[model samples]
Target chain A: MSNISLSAIFAETAEPCLATPEMNRATIFFLIVTVVGLSCGVLAFIFGHHTIYNNTREMPWGMLISTYAFWAITSTGLCMYAAMSHVFGGTRMGMISNRMVWMSIICIMGAFATIGVEIASPHRMLLYNIISPNPLSNIWWMGTLYGLAVGCMIIEFAGIVTGLGKLALVMGVFGALAEVLANSCLGGVFATLPARPYWYGAQLPIYFLTSAFLSGAAAAVLFNYLAYRIRNEKMSTTVHLAVKSAGKAMTLVLILYSVATFWRLVSFYVGGPELGRTAADALITGPLALNFWVLEVGIGLIIPIVLIILSRLENMSMLAFAGFLILVGQFVARYDLVVAGQNVPQNLGWDNLPTHFSYVPSFFEFGVIAGSIGVVAFGFLMGERVFGKTFTQKEHH
Target chain B: MNIEDLEKEKNEGIGSLPLQERREFLKMGLALTGVFLGGSILSMTSISHASNQKNADMDIPSEGQYPYPKHYGMIMRQNRCVGCELCVEACKQSNHVPNDHGAWRTAIQEKITRENSTEKREFRPVLCNQCNRPPCVRVCPTKATYKDPETGIVVMDYKKCIGCKTCMAACPYNARYFNEEKYAIDKCNFCIDTRLAEGKKETACAAACPARVRIFGDLKDKSTEIYRLLHTPDSKIWVLRPDTGALPNVFYMNA
Candidate 1:
């Protein structure tokens, strides 16, 4: 409450905090789009849930759940990345950890918002999750830990702004741990099911963690490039190294995750259960062939790896482009994973059984996606304004 | 309610209202009553009209510990099913399931293979297996759905369910449905709450099947029909989707 403490909220650095008119226009545009999408999300609550959403008894989880997983997983990646850089300190990743911390908080907020609409009673989840804890449920852990990560990140970011590096570092470590555990639990939510054979596995916890690394590394490069470009400043050597460093990690994880994906398919065909193989077949040569072969496998993994290699990790624009493609592929990949897992009916021999339950996300679903994107964009712009100077300064080992 | 009275009312306006006003009044009244009666009718239809249980009413009250000395189960003679689907109808009425939801608590799937002559068409009545190790119970975050300690039935606490439908995905039988009316996940609990809670020994579906295809009784009771059926080594018995490892209480004969 003191004058010095209040004033200390703003970093006392000589660097100017300024945005061009074009930047102002861009912010306004983002704000408009966000508001429009938010209104659509609100409309689902206002009119009725069943009215807007195309989800049925057959396919309970629709695109909204997929979008939630997409954002939540991305947020986990960001937080983990931040924790690694700052906790170790004296690394290029550490220098950019502040930005990553801020975005991680924002991205999780987007994830929460999407799932907020998806769950029928989110308020009860908040209250009862504490009062009536179920250690057995993976979903319970996912929700509770994500909530913990978000809280810790907020305090850690505040500590960073206040020049309390030690406090921030400690909180960053806990926040990172929570995010990683929560990320694995998120995977366990699907992977723990014995009934859903496609999702049932011991490897998913590790697989999902690998995905987080890939998404997080790519995000670090893309957002960092965008941040510098918006400032109309040349890339600093330290920041360039940070961006390229992310590129290298991304290349490695993309290859590993792709191998995991390959084995996941191959294992199904080789003496896997009948229904499980049928589900796998849908991904290989059936309805989801395009999403798997083109977007998830080719564009998401291979293309980005190719681009990073061809650019020799030098071109910022190319790295960012690859990052963008990686993100697009992740989005589609999450959708296909969720949809494909449940597409095959439990009874294969039953008469009139649908090969796959059709789920084409309506515009309301798109609104939720747009709204989630808006959340990240708004938070990113705000972070630039608040911590612009801090992000520009370089920290060394 | 009275068709002849409605005809007379349409011909002559009631009280001081005009002909058009009277018609609107009737429409509004009918809509209100329809909404009000729709749910009650669904719940009460089978309870009121079905053939009554021969056993005297058992006025059993609650205890702190487990109440029932048995775990109830069903054995369906699959070949005996004539594909009448009356069991499906009885289940819907007993559970108060909505017709337009495109979901059912129980259903009959016909398996017609041309290779077999007499056994060409066979109806398989599939319901919630009430697994000993229920995936629905395990995956529920709030313990919203759980196993009944007394009956060993996988029952749902309607109050606790968040309608996440995680249980639906976890159930390999495809037995769970989200009730838009109750705003909860609906599944077969062997009509434990509806029939058994009210002193009936068997589910409405088991009772309603005229061909006696379904034999329902306590698995723990040696004298019960279901117990005898399972104890017999001569008859071949199987559960649906054994690969799921649900360990279902519902067994199918003639598989």
Candidate 2:
């Protein structure tokens, strides 16, 4: 092992091909779904954002922003978790860090797809983010650092595919650092808003990073289980241990995130701005009550925490279900957060609204979200086909 | 789930204020409902009502405009404003703002109710507040919206605007609207490009107001009406959503 040549290692770690008709069909299906959903966003872009999107002067943001946050945060979580395990080189979770690296890339791509549709001038975004950078803006740092992270992750993944461990490890560490910072900035983008007092403060950045772990672990477990199921192969013992370790991690983060969420609400009632308090009220008892209670708290937090405990880290089906629930809850949690901040009237008492302002995503907005999900599914299945065996190539130091 | 388990999170109380122990209160599940029904709910009502009256009635500038050489702003005389909405129309024509999608450089919000046998309407015309510490300018990643150093107006460089709407979301006044025709954000810029550059003394809205609702001028000129209005004792000056701390150049008064 000590005398092994670089060429020999490159020869050992090889990409897998789709050998069955069913595998080909699945990949093609996801590709078609992604293409169709993405086409709707393109059409909306060709028209005007106001023409297709249900967004109004009152509620400017809607579901697309929430969904974008969901995917982007998930990507950061996966990248951070993998980078932590791999770069630090101690946690047993490093066994599956390679697969996580691949997913993080795909998830960020999903985020980019949604935001690309949301922005009216995406072409300008690419140019202006570099030349005319606003150093004071959180959005600027989030965009720039996320772009850097994506570049690093892609190169690192390519290095991994070609069995260049040294190059992959170096890029992986840099990519993870960029992801954490970008992710914090993404939180800051919301937190720094003086207008939306509900979202204002330092808590969101920390909360966002903490929630990333919960989502990252769930996604890793769910995708890895699905990848193996596609091949109809039995799980190797070491890989099983890796998934179990992720489940434990998810359980712990889920509890912590739950506590963080509770305190955020409590703090709002205690001393937050009036407008901020109403925004919290909207989530607590107003229009978004069902989503907040049933989905975010009940399903996203409680059920996942309880299910992970009951499964005892062994049952694959139990773990997968908990992951699905956590993902669903986290998705709605984002929707509630974004919506609640804007739900209160900007004019407040003078706007003549019977209650907090309202917004429902137009058909195009839903299409954009579906498109983002399709990107995730499409990438994951293809990764299974192209790098199936590569994921199983465990590195234990 | 037990009392002992609950007691373990003793170190989690982070805030130093003597407010109610919200952590324990939250466990009861009724705290949210109670808080909303309380007096603080009224604090969520209006841009005007939400601000502390003492804070809103802040004394006008005494420093005599040394900070900004050309502090361009408007003073809304709320008592003089009628619900005619002529200013809203004049602004559209002057700025070339299209009528659809509620796109206007300025708007009149009429809060009306029945007073005895007559209907009383209170009209407040809202435009860009043009903050001294403008959140819109600060949040624009591309530097699309910026404070014009020459005049202290929050001006838009439409060519650079990517239509991200972060400015729209960040604005406390909801002053900005996406201009479909231009494919960029459009808002009241004190007529910087349209009229002011054309040698007009005041904004189109201020110029067209029959009731003399809007008073636009340069605060840098202490002789200008804006400075005089602010410097006057018993001025009773106010600004919209002052709690946001944007420190708007636009001030409101009732005389």
The candidate that achieves the highest TM-score relative to the unseen native structure: 2
| Clash pairs detected, candidate 1 | none
Q: For residues B152-235, could you state the per-residue lDDT of candidate 1 as single tens digits?
A: 888888777776778888888888887767667888889988989999988989999998888898877778887777666445
RMSD of 2: 10.9
List clash counts for every candidate, in order: 0, 1
Residue A377 shift from truth in candidate 2, angstroms: 0.7
Candidate 1 TM-score, true structure as reference: 0.86
Residue B12 lDDT, candidate 1, scale 0-100? 45
**What DockQ score does model 2 reach against the true complex?**
0.50
**Whose DockQ is greatest here?**
2
Compose the digit string of candidate 2's lDDT tens values, residues A1-397. 4357755644555344455888778778888888988888898778888899887776778888888889999999999888888788867678888889999999999999998888888888888887899999888898899999999999898778776678888899899999999999989989998899999988999999987888899998898888778878767888888888888888888989989999999998998689889999998999999999999989888888778878888988789789989999999999999899898987766647655877888888888888889899999887776676668877532
Instruction: List, residue by residue over B119-207, the lDDT tens digit for candidate 2.
Output: 77788888999888899999999999898888889989888888778888899999988899989888899988988889999899999
Cα misplacement distance, residue B247 of candidate 2 (Å): 0.5
Give the DockQ (2 decimals) of all models. Answer: 0.36, 0.50
